[model samples]
Target: MIWIAIRMLTGDRQKYYGLIFGIAFSTLLITQQLTIFVNLVERGASGTYNVPNADVWVMDGVSRTTDVNYPMPSTALDRVRSVPGVEWAVPHLRASASVRSGDGDLEGVSIIGVDDATLIGLPRNMVEGSADVLSQPDSVIIDDVGVTRLFEDGRSPIGERLELNDQRAVIRGIADAVPGFTSQVTLYTKYSQALRYVPGTRNRLSFVLVGAADNVSADELARRIHEQTGLRARTRDQFARDGIEFIVRNTGIPLNFGITVGLGFIVGVAIVGLTFSLFIRDNIKQFGALKAIGVTNAKIRAMVSAQAGLVGFTGYGLGVIGTMLFIWGFSANPFFKGFYIPWQIPLVSLAAVMLILALTGWLALRNVLKTEPASVFR
Candidate 1:
């Protein structure tokens, strides 16, 4: 009986191909849009996540995110270090500055200053040079993405001189850092070097990154710091969430992506419902003939289910393959770098496909079930 149903579905190449394309296209749309959305919002937390050694981040009470922060007094670092649970606290500076490339092109760039002695905030990996290169006089490390933007000729950015805040910044190395949401060029330097690169104000410290002592929980240390210092304190995960929330509250990305995903759902339902209904209606005579031969409705249902299952699996597999190819192809492009399809997204898409098939299949089956066995003669 199942073989007969499979034959019936495959016999109509036009409708079968149409159904597969519809489901595949819909799945592609939903999965692709969601992937891009997730990666874009996550860029907000890239700064926090890049510094793997810091268990807690101390900032001004009003600071909302890593980029949108208020510079605290320099003494703020000392206050944080005074906390008992803090094993060590280092000052971190993040500020924006304009840079002049070799061709006199002006670009806005982010300046990140890590701990001088330990280089605690530097990225774990280096693309071209060692992290110790920042220790050189007037030295800085440009992010790999920034190297592409600043030096487009594929020449080595090493030893290239950039003008920042009327100071000479020599790119001594290339750091493999994640690009921020705006894709701004980022430069990493020692704390003192960054102060020189960025036009300084009285308060130079933007944040204090802390390491918790042995046996001390990050959450507990953060709590104690907040209580004693009267400054905002957040565990690493909490601060990352703050960054994401900042983007969500300020941007329209979520709404736009939500609409795109909803449209994918609608398209899938419309195409699948129409094609499935027509296919079932055209086979109504066949269904009646089987009923007349003593085949039960339960058997008929199993037949329809088998047909739906075949179409669903085939379409879903093609869609996922398409998505993987899309991500892999664009991985080299800076904007799409580090973008990945989260496992949960595929599961969600699968549930959507199942719901679409079940609803359309049930509606199409109603007409076949109501037809009397005598209808085979009509």
Candidate 2:
């Protein structure tokens, strides 16, 4: 029965192809937009992710995210270090500075200052040169994303000189760091060097990166630091979530992507519904003939379901493949770097595809179910 139904569906190649295309197009749009959206929002946590070693982030009470932070007095580091569960605490500086590139064009860049002795705040991996290069005089490391922005002509930024706040900064290395939410160019230097590069303020410390003692969990350490110092202390994961939430609350990205996903659902329903209805209308006599034979309405329902299942499976697979190809093709683009479709996104798309098939199939089935056995004589 299912085989016969599939053959009937395939008999009309135009409608058959149209149905599949509709499902596939909708799946691709929904999945692709969702993948990009997730990746973009996740960039809000990139600063925290780049500094892989920190267990706790101690900052001023008013500071919300790594980027949207209020500077704290240098003594804040001492207060966090005094906390019992803290094994080590270092001063971390994150500030924005305008730099005069080698070409004399002024560009805004984020300055990250890692511990001078431990380099704990630098990214775990370096794309070029060694982390030890920061030991060189007037040295700073540029992130890989920054490399493309600062040197657009495919020229190497290594040894490139920039003027920041009347101080010379030599690009000594390239850090394999995640791009920030704004895809801002980031330069990492020793804490002391960053202090000189960025315009001086009364409170120079932006955050105190802390390592919890082996016996203490990050959460416990965070609570202890917060209780003792009356400062904002967040575990690494909590701080990352904070950054992500801040972006979601502040930006229109969620609403924009949501509207796009809704449109995909609507488009799928429109195309698939119209084509399926036409298919059922043209094949009315066949359905009536089957009813006249031993085939019951229950059997007829199964046949239609089999057809819908086939279309949904084929279309869903093709759409997901198309999305994967799109991501792979643009992987080299700085903006699309590190983009990945989460596991749950595909599951959500699958549910959407099934809903589309069920809705359209149910509507198209009404006429077939109501057909009288004698209607075939007409």
Candidate 3:
């Protein structure tokens, strides 16, 4: 019976192909937009992820995210270090500054100050030069993304000099760091050097990166620090989630991507509904003949389900493949770096495809079910 239903569906080349195209387009649209949306929002947490060594991040009470933090007093570092569960604490500074490139082009950049002695806050990966280069006079490491922005002419930024806050700065290394939500250029220097590059304020310590003692968990250590110092302390994972939530709350990105995904489902319904209705109308006589031969309406329902299943499966596979190819082709672009399709995204798309098929199939089946056994003779 299922084989017969499959044959009936594929027998009509035009409508059959139309149904597949509808499902594939919907799946592709939803999956691709969702993949891009997820990646963009996850960029908010890139700052925390870049500094992998930090088990806990201690900051001012009102500071919500890494990018939106208020500077804390330098004494906050010592206070956090005093916490029982803290193994070590390092002063971390993040501030915005304007830089004059070698070509005299002025660009706004984020200045990150890693610990001078241990260099604990710098990104672990270096693209071009070693992290040891920061030991040189006035040397700073540019992030990989910043290299593309600051040196757009394909020139090497390795020896490029910049004037940051009227202070001479040299780029000696390229750090393989994730670009922030704003995709701003980032330069990493020693904490002391960064103090000179960025305009000074009464409180210049943006955060304290803390390593938890082996005997304590990060969450426990964070709790102890917060209780002891009256400061906001978040475990690494918690802080990362905070950054992601901040973007969702502040930006219209969620609504925008959500609307696109909704439209894809609607489009799938429209296209598949029209095509499936036409298919059932043309096959009404066949359905009536089957009914006349003692084939029940229950059997007819199963047939229709089988047909929808085939279309949904084939279309869903094609859509996923198309999305994969799209991501692969653009992987080399700096903007799409580290973009990945989450596993859950494909399953979400598959459920959408099934819902589209089920809804359209049910509507299209109504006419077939109502067909009288005598109608075949008419």
lDDT of 2 by residue, 1-378 (tens): 889999999998999999999999999999999999999999999999998899999999999999999999988888888889799999999999999998998889999999999999999999999999999999999999999998999999998999988999999899999999999999999999999998777999999999999999999999999899999999899999999999999999999999999999999999999999999999989989999997999999999999899899999999999999999999999999999999999999999999999999999999999999987886
In candidate 1, where is summed lDDT lowest over 10 consecutive residues? 192-201
TM-score of 1: 0.98
TM-score of each: 0.98, 0.99, 0.98
Candidate topping TM-score: 2
Query: In terms of TM-score, how similar is model 3 to the real structure?
Result: 0.98
Candidate number that wins on TM-score, 2 or 3: 2
Q: Per-residue lDDT of 1-378 in model 1, one digit per residue for the tens? A: 999999999999899988898889888888899889989999999999789899999999999888999999999999999999899999999999999987799999999999999998999999998998987899999999998888888899999998898899899999888788898999999998898888767998999999999989999999999999999999999999899888888999999999999999999999999999999998999999999999999999999999999999999888888999999999999999789999999998899899989999999999988989997887
User: What clash pairs does model 3 have?
Assistant: none
lDDT by residue (tens digit), candidate 3, 196-281: 98877799999999999899999999999988999999999999999999999999999999999999999999999999999999
Worst 10 residues of 2 by lDDT: 193-202
Task: State the lDDT at 218 in candidate 2.
Answer: 98
